[model samples]
Target: MKGKDHFLVAGRITWDFRRLSEEETDWGNKILFLPAAKNMSMLVVESSPWNANDFGIPYPTYFHPAKDSEVFEWQERMRSLERKWLFSFAGAPRPDNPKSIRGQIIDQCRNSKVGKLLECDFRESKCHAPSSIMQMFQGSLFCLQPQGDSYTRRSAFDSMLAGWIPVFFHPGSAYTQYTWHLPKNYTTYSVFIPEDDIRKRNVSIKERLLQIPPEQVKVMRENVINLIPGLIYADPRSELETLKDAFDVSVQAIIDKVTRLRKNMIEGRTEYDNFLEENSWKYALLEEGQREAGGHVWDPFFSKPKPGEDSSSDSNGGTTISADAAKNSWKSEQRDKTQ
Candidate 1:
């Protein structure tokens, strides 16, 4: 199985078994849930952060594409709409979760005169209404996309669908994920406010957004609107001859990745033969130079917490896996394979 071509299309959610029960963890380990270098022949296309050998595809958005002409028309319409709010956020507060900054975001949006808040609590029916959500997004210049249950949210894609720029709090929310769909330079399509700044009350979201020049904002919004075609899934019943939807983009990326992998394997390039799968995010996605580089822009956000400390206490809301644990897991698996 070393060089056999295989592919695993992970369903909607990306599976990370770090917090699972002991029994479940054992089950996951046996099945290669935490895939290592040996699994290089197998391409795991998932929606979560995984090894460089695998691919990260975008979560499907509610928006469905029909043709390029309709999409272009919608983009023009969205551009012409009068944006009343500087920034808006639509999410439920997680008061029980100390790491979450939703409450802070809610309070800030409510207090700021330029911001709009759509609190999606038990009573907010509009939160579930797609039309209402799109309306809100259409009226806003920026949509706040903080980490939900997972780092990635459908809302980010939805916001982009409305031709509004999404403001992310974590790199995992967009920067690290959805590489195939979104622009490599995150600033071209979206804005990022460090979650730590919000947690520490050190920065004002409104003030920060206002600092960006109008000309720059226009360029970013256009970039986001242009991304709508690639982000959405086209109605399967109808073909999108003029544009490539999410499906097309994802499939093409998988093909390209597999082709490169097959070439490397055939050519006897041993670099990835024993490459630590855990560092794929760093080496494959984040840094082109890898070890020789100083560091990635997103490096500061993914720092590991000290021993006996919860990762939430760190800057990035404690959602990412620790590098130490990832390295150890790969080493242990390699030893098991050798034995």
Candidate 2:
């Protein structure tokens, strides 16, 4: 796409940089080459907006936001069956960080009678299935969701999809980052306990969830079920799907952004139009070179009006402009890059 004249596409291609040293301590040589990919993209569809902003790249939307096909099934199955356990945790300890919140939560949760700690031994036992993790969530009223390898964990969403209320230990785990996808007020469906508080044993996750009345917990579970559709990137080929999935929303947003950019350029409000117009002569040269290179006639870079051509003026004769004319400014950029 660099030279073929295509819009740059990017995704959340990296891990949580803030905790990189802790998470990627094993990657001695690879760590140095990781951050070099920053700003190499025009638009990014990422999970953690906090990390996206930290990288200083334009992330228009959050895509493929942690959802699964078995989600509805889990939710339905858990709904009819009474939740047997008060709380549950299924993840292993992050031994890299000696004082990790996950490790602390595991220890504390195991000691408490109200909590169930399932030591996920999938790595050790080939017989252990991943569905067992969902089973744990399904039977629990609340699920302990601490940050895993990254600030964001897929388990939090999995817990919710299982019709269990997620108890988040870190703000980055789900609260501040996923504003576009999650509820504006997080407390509506999930619980937020500061990582510091949880680590220090200052706040008991069980005590807090117990304080939430049964009726409120019912409301929260319903809210979590309702959120499953939007959070999921539904199978596009599935005709049974009618809801707006994450993929549908992200593609629509990209279309809307391009439309807005084209509109602003036509209306002479875009910063690129004038700058490109002043250098319209370069487009002619670029167009000739592109044509020689077997480029298509519909290239956006060659749409600018020549020095004395009819500049698509407004209805009030305020200077005419076409979508072609609007996109003319990009030619110089492409030309410069070609050299």
* Candidate models: Cα lDDT each: 0.71, 0.53
| Number of the top-ranking candidate, with TM-score as the measure | 1
Q: List the residue pairs that clash in candidate 1.
A: none
* Model 1 local distance difference test score: 0.71
Question: Candidate 1 on 207-280: residue-level lDDT in tens?
Answer: 99999999999999999988888888888888888789988987787677667667877887643434554445
Q: Against the true structure, what is each candidate's TM-score?
A: 0.83, 0.60
* Candidate 1 weakest lDDT stretch, 10 residues: 41-50
RMSD of each: 7.7, 18.7
Residues 55-86, candidate 2: write the lDDT tens digits: 11212212232334455664466577678889
| Collision count of model 1 | 0
Off by over 4 Å in 1: 1-4, 16-19, 24-54, 270-274, 286-294, 305-309, 320-339
